[model samples]
Target: MGEGNWARVKIILRSPASRLKGVCADARFSGPVGRPAVAPVLCINGPEDKLFRSQSADITLSSEKERIKKMLSEGSICEMNLEVELFALQDSNAKLVAALHEANANVEQWKKQLSAYQEETDRLRDQVADLETHGGHGPSDLLKDELTQSLEELESLLKAKDEEIHILQSKKSEYHELERDRGEAIHRLQELEMRNMDLERRVQNAEQTLASSLEERDRAENEVHRVIDILDVKIFDLNDLRQSLAKLIDK
Candidate 1:
């Protein structure tokens, strides 16, 4: 058996043995209050309880053997899968080796082609220099005229580019000035808003002060009316006393 199968078999065997030991221990420690108190049986043939325990142990062993057989079969399957993977890896490695050989052959062919191209380029350059040294005067004059015309066109294009750059610079300056004016306007607007808030607060405070003064004036007017009413009552009582004295004198 493989190592994994052997380990599983050992675990299965140990678990049942431990369980049987626990069962025996529980029976030995059982109390007489819960279990019936009976004398031990001594038979000439065999003990009946021992027979029952032996049958249970046989059943447990058979189950464990079946589990071991199943684990061995699984392990064999895993080995076969590992073998298939190893063969696939070997085939891939062989293909990679062949590709590397093909690439090396391609590199050799490219080197040969590059060498041939370099030889042709050198031969053409030599032919061009020889023609320039010994060729006729008429073709050279034509080439010089073409070169002068090309230089004049290039100079005119450069002047136009410089003028365009200057115009763009002036426009950029105007844009910066506009940006500065916008920032100033925003700052001024913020200042005006703050001033408006301060003015509003002062107006509210003045209104409150005016309302308090009006309340104090109304209270003073009411007190003055009360004093005038008391004075009029005292004057009427004096006039009645004077009239009674005059009548007594006449009688």
Candidate 2:
């Protein structure tokens, strides 16, 4: 965890065989000569966010240079904590889909019940007609009351079912929209991850190239210094020979 200006971390990695610094650059070591090639940086400002639970610390990274320095000094991290959070988000999305499916199933069941009620109403009407045809008289008070009561009850039940369907439909639509938004979010995350991977690879390549260039430059400079020293020595010998020839001529 990043406490103050410096962060605390534990990592295990072997130093590259080509490393100029023969000693392993682990956290236990000290100074520029013993620094590790790679160090993990605890990101104070993560893009996705909610990774760390931090108390209010007033560590200000106010400049872009500072941010870059921090990023380079200690490389980025992709941790178990972040993965667990993403998995939780995915699980929540799945539960939402399941709930939507259940609501849709409920809607279908309500439609079936509604159809059954209509069929029953038709059957009652047919019975009423058949009795009227046989008796050629009006319906009995008890029969009229019962038929009216049944129709009224059916109407109320249908209204309630309609309201339920409306509510379910609204909820289903909401879930679908949420699913679409989540799909977009996942797509964005995939693109960002790919870009980050590409950038990290490029950075590694750049560092290798830079180190090689610096080594070559230093070798060239050393050769130049050796050549200059040799030329100076020859010049000194030439001056001594000129003085000897002058003395011989004078004698």
Q: What is the lDDT of residue 87 in candidate 2?
A: 71
* Model 1 TM-score, all chains together: 0.41
RMSD of 2: 23.6
Winning model by TM-score: 2
Residue-wise C-alpha lDDT for candidate 1, range 82-150, written one tens digit per residue: 455555555555565565566557556655755665555466555556667788423355555654565
Task: Single out the weakest 10-residue window by summed lDDT for candidate 2.
Answer: 52-61
Error of 2 at 79 (Å): 10
**Candidate 1 lDDT for residue 173:** 64
